[model samples]
Target: MNPLLCGLAANPALPPELVDRLLTLALEEARADPASQFADDLLHGLADRADLRHDQILELAAHSDTMARYLAYGGTLDAADVDPGSMPNAAVALLDERRGNLAWARFLATHPDPQIRWKLASCPGLPQDAVDLLAADPDEEVVKELALWTDSPVTARLALHPDPEVRIAAAANPSTPLEAVIVLAADPELTLKWTLSERTDLPQALYARLAADPHAGVRATYASNPGIGQELIRVLAADPELQVRRAVAKHPRIPLDLLAELVVGDRAGWNLLPRIAAATPAELKEPAGSRHAAVRMLVAQRRDLPPHLREALAVDPDASVVRAVAPHPGLSEELLRAMVARHGVQVLAAVAANPDASGPLLEYLTQHRPGVRRVLKEVAEHPHATGPALLACLADRTSRPLAAAHPALPPEAITELLADEDHQVAEAAAGNPSLPRAVMLELMP
Candidate 1:
């Protein structure tokens, strides 16, 4: 009988003679017929035994390592009829490559071999019952892997784990149940709260509570929050670590009223601002031109910067501050123009959309071509320019009605805008200032 014909033979099951045929096919395949060694014939012969008793299947498993290995390698275990006798050992191999059935996997999920259990935890159809059973596995490696796999909804169940490492492991899962993680954040164990607070989406309320946690590490997370609550911030400010203190100093949300206090020291613990020649409001108006670029850069980003602060930045030693002021909403046209003239196109592009920008700024955009309708709107908003000048820009075919229904545009400015040919521009104008009287007459047609 052709060996290839063995699969469709009268006795399809692993009839004893079929093994001898498969072995012969393997030899024929070895000489250079790579296709003959294919496990299909062997797998078919093994799988054909639908009536094999569970013990008989396991007995077959013990008798021939070659057959067991073939079944494990091919991932075609149906012929085994029942879980193989060496299921745990077979599982260790298939689970590694992600190629086994749920029954094969669950058999060794609690197997004495840590390697076997770890691999099973990662199996795609790992049963929840298996997960629940292994939750108490002594190996931290096993516990940690399970934690990563257990979706957050189920992570809460593991929180009661007596091991702090396990609880913290559960906390590290991005999907850890919010309630469970939140409760863990207040856990008396310093490690638990400290670990939980590092998660960015943890509720602000929970973070604030951790800000004053007895453990310094727990408080570190709050220190890093640029937008920490003012009350929580006060607690972090008192933290002993200089690094934590620096984080507080750099936080964008700290009120200018408090920024004054950070003026004293540098990252090196020495007065670093002397180089920049600027200081927080308490020590000085702004950083000196030759001062630390970081301090000045930080000042440039400060939303609290007032007119005086901007003026101070106008001649800032580093072009960064002046560049920052070029786009600053708070700066006057006079100040913005000075910065743009000093720094050129890049800074000009940043605030090109400010409605308060001047005609000169609009004029600059024309020179640069980098200025789109976005820049024109800034010119329209500049306090010095007449409404007519801004209205003419609405005539821009490039980008019509830069700021539609913008509250800052005057009623007359809005009225004339209605005649704009561009539909979007005309719509913006029609919706503006109760519609232009001129438009009302024109639309009558």
Candidate 2:
């Protein structure tokens, strides 16, 4: 058998004689015809094997292919024998692949090429001294790479570096110490302050300070920061810039009274009422009787409101308010039925989807509102849905997917759904625990 063919077979246990013959032929051919495909194949095969002689290793390193050089030099080749300057970038990368190759690492550490220095910066096992040296590298790219090493002592130095780009990278690194971040926060560059404002651990004083920043963009960040307490929220709520005040309205921690004031007073007309309505029950009460229908609608959706207030909002003249109250868990049964009778199917759909919806109401909506697909789908999946209601939903092809998955679906309906033309329907049927043992077994891969 040809030695090259034997090597290509990848049989690690090939006889020693076969290995020696293959190496000899491959080296000779590679030297005579450097571009030979057969020689390249044999060289690659021998590159991964540990049986290469010292001369064979050197021969492979000197080969024209960079890949062949990387494979050869990646092994036990001495640093002196390998010329780092002449080697291609790819070959240089291969040397750093293995950890703790101190000789190669130290030689490449100062290897004039910035690309080599950049790669070294990412090595976790790189020595601290080498990291320090790279941190001060003239090239911003090299320094930027070092900025990512959060634990490096050099990150603090880079944070204050004259280059805004380097400072920005350091500021963004979560590992950069708080002291360094505070300095970056005050940096004249709006971009640096913007990056620093995103840090969750920003000091309360900083939040307050950034809130009054000359630039709307910086104050906007402060407005959006959840850590901003009521004091900062109050300040931002009254900001001259409508955009900043709008951001305060969306803030999760803004005082309820302040949000109400913004809803009623801010002339920006940004539609901040929905967010205020979503506030905790305690907050919702602050804006309970605001003239804005949007604000009133949100207040009506709160479950914590007193019965009188909820009942009054439920019967409010505004259809949107009535619709909002329809989904409130604390909504009275009388009010829900009244809303369903008075409002259109849109309001009824919200009621049908509410977990607090009564069984009788769900049945009523299921029977009378079958034309609305959303309402029917919600009714089909309702925990209180009646047997007849689920059957009605299953009968409609549009609502079958949701109906087929309902626990109330009968075994016969499930069997019928198993053969549904819609794959989603069939898949839902397969996953239903009520499916027969034989049916489940058939669904197995």
Q: Write the per-residue lDDT of candidate 2 for residues 1-445, one digit (tens) a residue.
A: 2332422323344445655666677778777987887777666766676666677667667765375356634664554456655653434455455423444555666778787788776666566767777786778888887786546667788888888888888887767888998888777773655666656677889777767779997888778777777777887887898888878877876666666666665545343344554565555555667677766865765656667777788888778778777776777677788887787775878788777887778778877743577777888778887667787787667778777767667877876777777766775565454655554434322
TM-score for candidate 1, please give it.
Answer: 0.36
lDDT string, candidate 1, 1-445, tens digits: 2322332221223234443444345344434553553434533454445444454445445534455555555554443333434556555455544565555555576677797677666554466777765676778788777776665345787776777777888887766777877777668783655565446677667777667667665566567564467776766776787666666655546654454455434533223222123345643443433255545655665445566765677656567556555555666777666666666655665556445666555656545545445455555455544444455455555435554444345676655555545555555554443443444333321
lDDT: which candidate is best? 2
> What's the lDDT of the predicted structure labeled candidate 2?
0.68
lDDT of 1 at 445: 16
In model 2, where is the ten-residue run with the lowest total lDDT?
A: 1-10
Give candidate 1 misplaced runs (Cα > 4 Å). Answer: 1-223, 226-280, 283-294, 303-309, 327-335, 349-373, 380-392, 395-399, 403-423, 441-445
Provide the RMSD of all predictions against the true structure, rounded to 1 decimal. Answer: 23.2, 15.6
Candidate-wise lDDT, in order: 0.55, 0.68
| Backbone N/Cα/C clashes per model | 16, 0
